[model samples]
Target: MRTTALLFSLSISFGSLAQLQPIAADVYRWKDLKIEKEQTRERRQVLEGSARDLDLLEIHTSALEPGKSPHPPHTHDDVEELVIVKEGNLRVTIKGQSKILGPGSVALAIPGEEHGFENGGNTRVTYYIIKYRSKLPMNIDRGKQAGGSFMIDRSELTVKTTDKGSRINYFERPTSMAQRFEMHVTTLNAGMNSHPPHTHRAEEIVLLISGSGKIQIGEQHKDASVGDLIFLGSEVLHAFTNTGQEPCSYFAFQWN
Candidate 1:
């Protein structure tokens, strides 16, 4: 491909030199995303990887028929993908190993790993894939990393207390194979919030799993319900509150 100055800039920004960060703060209601159809499956793009957003981070949700695969097992040269099952049983295949991850389960696919998945049950399966290429080196040495795809089931999430609620830490570079992120599931009781509105240097994505809630970004506020993927960019003050009668839960993953 012919390289333009803009393209060159992007290359440098995504090349192990923290030159750019993907995506500024934003929020996406699942119902608002338009699905793109394919022969074997369909997907909705929530965030596209671009120089303006950050160098190479993307967010999308996909659904497949009971017996279909999104594609054959494959590998990316530089992108690491996180698959979070939203519904049904998703059979993920990495290399020659395979496992069926249920709803709320998380699967990791590092760059250079052969990975793909399909709905192995009788019903359709919906899931979200967060793929990104980290420009910054991890705090841990790469040679010490245990690289491969693995599943973290929802049943395994250990609940711990927070000031107003509780949470479960699922993945992080220090304990997981990923070099760029940490993910957690937090729950807030009805009409409660963990804290006041705040902002941070890291970018994050919050996907609601259950109950009713509200997310405030800057001066604007919106309802947070099941199936919504809310994106909060660096330095954009945001906060949340459970608006429903039951506890609200969500999966939150952020990168430095």
Candidate 2:
């Protein structure tokens, strides 16, 4: 009877695993906009994953062709956006300051802040966009006629930034996870194609979407490839580098 029970458990586990689906590629392609005179060609929006249970939304990969631009300067009064560059370079205009972001770099645009982007480089630009909405909206309009107004209050929102090897571009109040704080990860490739050695107040998990490198977490420094995941604890000095011929790209989520 014990053996039969064990076999049944194994079957259930396999069934659960089989039910999981990878992030769809078609979702990454942004097709709602018309191609104009701009040099931009390709555009897509891929929904990587989301944790509805934890109020977390993850947009795995988004690409913009050379000379293409996203929406004009806009703001989400209640949602916090974290963007991480995967390949090529992107020019971000935040409050009129234009900065070129390369692979492994990240930026955070606060609610009510004017922000937008353009593929300022010759290569295609891909990046990860994560959105944390305190209150999920009842309707989502993907068309151009949809109202561009925000429904939440901006003064009540709080924001913060931290610098690890990859920068913690922006953060709000920490979410409580088993008595620990939680923050979104926004890793950028800046110095020497990698980040510096530093620790943080919360634990973190990393997912590599592009480039190649090694992740040093505590004493375990392991090779990182596309689709690799790394977990880190609070106060653990972690770092990463671009070990491949091209640039490295990844995102880290910190949860205490």
Candidate 3:
């Protein structure tokens, strides 16, 4: 009877752990997503899994009609969220300050920061949300010292022109859940490769904003269109090439 009780307890403990496996390095197409229509908006779940440094990594897209908000401003004590505008205009409020941002804009809300979003334009507004929690303990003070939560427009950033294309730096700072977080936009001319396959210690995400391309991850090559996303795990060799006739642009964000 004692042995049976011990076995039952062990089974329950193991079952309580997350059954979701770690996400692989691959491209997630936008068209492949299934939309779930809400009362005032539409939602599409992209990916939800674990990463090397994060206990949870989840991504989703939301589209809100004119003057609609998903919910009221709230605070997340354990999760950090990143919002990237894909289309239309978004009014993002972080800690009481609200700003209307157009496509390619980004908002970073650290843990415990009150944040909310809504469609600020007459048309529909679409954006991607990246929610994550670190494997380490949450440090709200560290994030606050690093600048707390904020939003930035893409046009406000400086663009570095190159022979192949241009690169725009977004930000690089520490968050409550990560020691280092960096984001940038890279545009590649037709038939141009962003770079030779490269590996980094931080896990990275490539979110295509314009044109089309192909991403090479390990031994696999996958096609990516506008609104598609590619996630590369730590130490994974990956590269992106503009396969279309026109130039392609993508946002690359990494953290550990």
Task: Give each model's clash number.
Answer: 6, 11, 0
RMSD of 3: 4.0
Best model number under lDDT: 3
Q: How close is each model in CA RMSD to the real structure?
A: 4.6, 13.3, 4.0
Better of 1 and 3 by TM-score: 3
As a TM-score, model 3 comes out at 0.93
Q: Which stretches of candidate 3 lie over 4 Å from their true place?
A: 1-17
Instruction: Give candidate 3's error at residue 36 in angstroms.
Output: 0.3
User: Each model's TM-score?
Assistant: 0.84, 0.45, 0.93
Cα-based lDDT at residue 238, candidate 2: 82
1-256 per-residue lDDT for model 3 (tens digits): 9999999999886675477579988888999999999987899999998999998899999999999999989999899999999999999999889999999999999987799999999999999999999989988998999998989998788889998899999999999999899999999999999989989889999999999998999888889999999999999989889999999999999997
Q: Which sequence of candidate numbers ranks them by lDDT, best first?
A: 3, 1, 2
lDDT of 1 by residue, 34-117 (tens): 989999989998876543224577788889999899888898866677899999999998877888889889988766668989
Candidate closer to the true structure by lDDT (higher is better), 1 or 3? 3
Q: Write the per-residue lDDT of candidate 2 for residues 164-204, one digit (tens) a residue.
A: 23343233333211222233434444333445778876545
Question: Where does model 2 exceed 4 Å of error?
Answer: 1-53, 134-205, 209-224, 227-251
